[model samples]
Target: MAGAMMLALADGGSFTLEWTHSVEREDWRETWEVTEDHRLHLTEAAVKGSGAGMEPGPGGHFEDGWWVWAPDLPPVPALTLAASGETPSAWTLCGEDCTQLGATSGQPVQVAPCPDAG
Candidate 1:
């Protein structure tokens, strides 16, 4: 299982969400940056062991009202979610096949692609 962390800017202008998984004594972290406009940016993704493999990827653009990050890595998969306003009343995390892996409501939002997702 993975754990999630969130940090909102002091001015409430930006926020970051991160997820971490432990592997071989190393922690792989996936992070997302949310701009004031509600645009989500993939700041860092991939394994964090030695802090060498983690590289920032071109984040997704705002579409409709959601921030969508397409799968760049095979196991990473893809992701989509609400971009603005208060925490979503409900949201879903889908796999590469678009299968729902998890869903939640009224909580700190933390989302990532399927595997090795950032």
Candidate 2:
């Protein structure tokens, strides 16, 4: 993530990334936290309804009109969300403050924990 945008963690080092699925047109959300090692830890995820590429993970259950589950994937260095510029709404990053991003065409947003400077 060198030379990319750097965002300090919020008080609890937790945040959520939200966006509308392009094919499903359904709202999707992923809750993540910054680990002490400066890696991104995805804790949970939810989607309005299942569709192409919207399959819920095993053990997912219905709750409040959403299919929610905890993905068992390992921590990632970073996550990238591509922008088509045709989305009705901007991708949202919510922590201490909410930021709308990647609404422009050809612009992509990459999210990662701020790594320690050496």
For all predictions, the C-alpha RMSD in Å is 15.7, 3.1
Off by over 4 Å in 1: 1-7, 10-26, 49-118
Model 2 per-residue lDDT tens digits across residues 2-114? 53556678323888899999877999999998877778889999999899999999889999999999999898888888878998668899987898877888657888776
For model 1, what is the error of residue 25's alpha carbon versus the real structure, in angstroms, after optimal superposition? 6.7
Q: Kindly report which residue pairs in candidate 1 clash with one another.
A: none
TM-score for each predicted model, relative to the true structure: 0.26, 0.86
List clash counts for every candidate, in order.
0, 0
Residue pairs with backbone atoms closer than 3 Å in model 2 (clashes): none
lDDT of 1 by residue, 26-109 (tens): 333344443434344454344333333333235744444333344354322224443333332223222222222224332344
Which portions of model 2 miss their true places by more than 4 Å?
1-6, 10-12, 116-118
